[model samples]
Target: MGAAITRAQIVEVADRLFYEQGFEATSFADIAAAVRLSRGNFYYHFRTKDDLLGAVIALRLANTEAMLDGWEGATPDPVERIRSFVRILIMNRARIMLYGCPVGTLCDELSKLRHVAKDDAAKLFMLFRRWLSLQFAALGREADADALALHALMRSQGIATLATAFQDEGFIQREVEDLLAWVEAQRPHQDRPTSETRPQP
Candidate 1:
């Protein structure tokens, strides 16, 4: 006989399966099979497919927030902090390639679900964008912070897509480095004092 599976284990397996195959493609039976349990046992833990999905979303959001924790204080330079955020994403390229960014993929899949889940996914992205905007504003760039935040968010998603399409980790690393350099160059220059225009009678 196989070892007994707990509710947490079932949810963990479901999360991976959902990430790999999407919510519609992964079923209770599939999750049960992975956990070596029956559909009835899976139901005992989750009650419904939506319930399982909610659990997955909650878990993913918590995990992502935890990863981003303390990131603000990681460096004194705002530009360095922004670069660190990108580096974190690049370092997790393999995982992102495997499961996709939870916020991005979940938001894409949200339309199929009811209101609460959709709202939660949307809120998660908003929070992410807000954080990026603050980081860009701190860099003292003259461009609109919202625009910069959107660009950064889009670049991340675009790089993840490129990784998925090309199956190349190097592509993301190269592009992230280039993007960081461009952002750094956008910082505003301090104005210099005029030489002979002031204090003349």
Candidate 2:
């Protein structure tokens, strides 16, 4: 008998193939072939390609939320938090470049799929943006935080797009590092205390 395959295993394999080859280009046969399964077995897991795509998107979103959870009870300083977030992005550059940031990529590609799907994607992006906004608000720089997060998101997507076009990892890495530096500079000096400490009353 063959090894038992789980739903998650199917989604994991499909996600990689979809990102590398693209949704329109990756067929059910290709996905099944990657998993060493029959096309009918694939159908047993996912009724249709669209259905599979939706599952993949959900999986990606869950993974992101999991990452966010790890930062719970993290530093209250917004600047530091934001910097840490950017570092996380830098560390995951490869996955970001390949999958194109799940929320951003899905919004771009699956907007026309269904009203519910589009709505879900929009909500997910908004939630992440709002979390960034709250972090900036904590630093009393809500306005700048909003602008910075938007810019960072755009720059991140731009890097992923460039990766696809130029096939250059160095270019993407440099761009991301530059963006992080720019963000750090934008932070207020008051947010960073000097070595000299004032005596408390």
lDDT of each: 0.74, 0.69
Residue pairs clashing, model 2: none
For model 2, the stretches where C-alpha displacement exceeds 4 angstroms are: 1-5, 93-106, 111-124, 193-201
Q: Write the per-residue lDDT of candidate 1 for residues 1-201, one digit (tens) a residue.
A: 323348778778988887788878888889999988877766778888889878777777787677556777677766676777678668788988677775677778776665457877677777778877887787775368888888888888888877777778788789988777656654554421233232211
Worst 10 residues of 1 by lDDT: 192-201
Predicted candidate 2 versus true structure: per-residue lDDT over 1-201, tens digit per residue: 433446778889888887766666789898888888887777877888878878877877787677665664676666666666667556767776666655566676666554356666576676667666767667677667787677766776677767656766788778767766665655566654565243321
Output the lDDT of residue 61, model 2: 76
Give the TM-scores of the predictions, in the order they appear.
0.78, 0.76
Q: What is the Cα-based lDDT of residue 193 in candidate 2? A: 53
Best by TM-score: 1
Model 2: ten consecutive residues of lowest lDDT? 192-201
- Candidate 1, superposed: residue stretches over 4 Å from native: 1-5, 97-99, 112-116, 141-143, 190-201
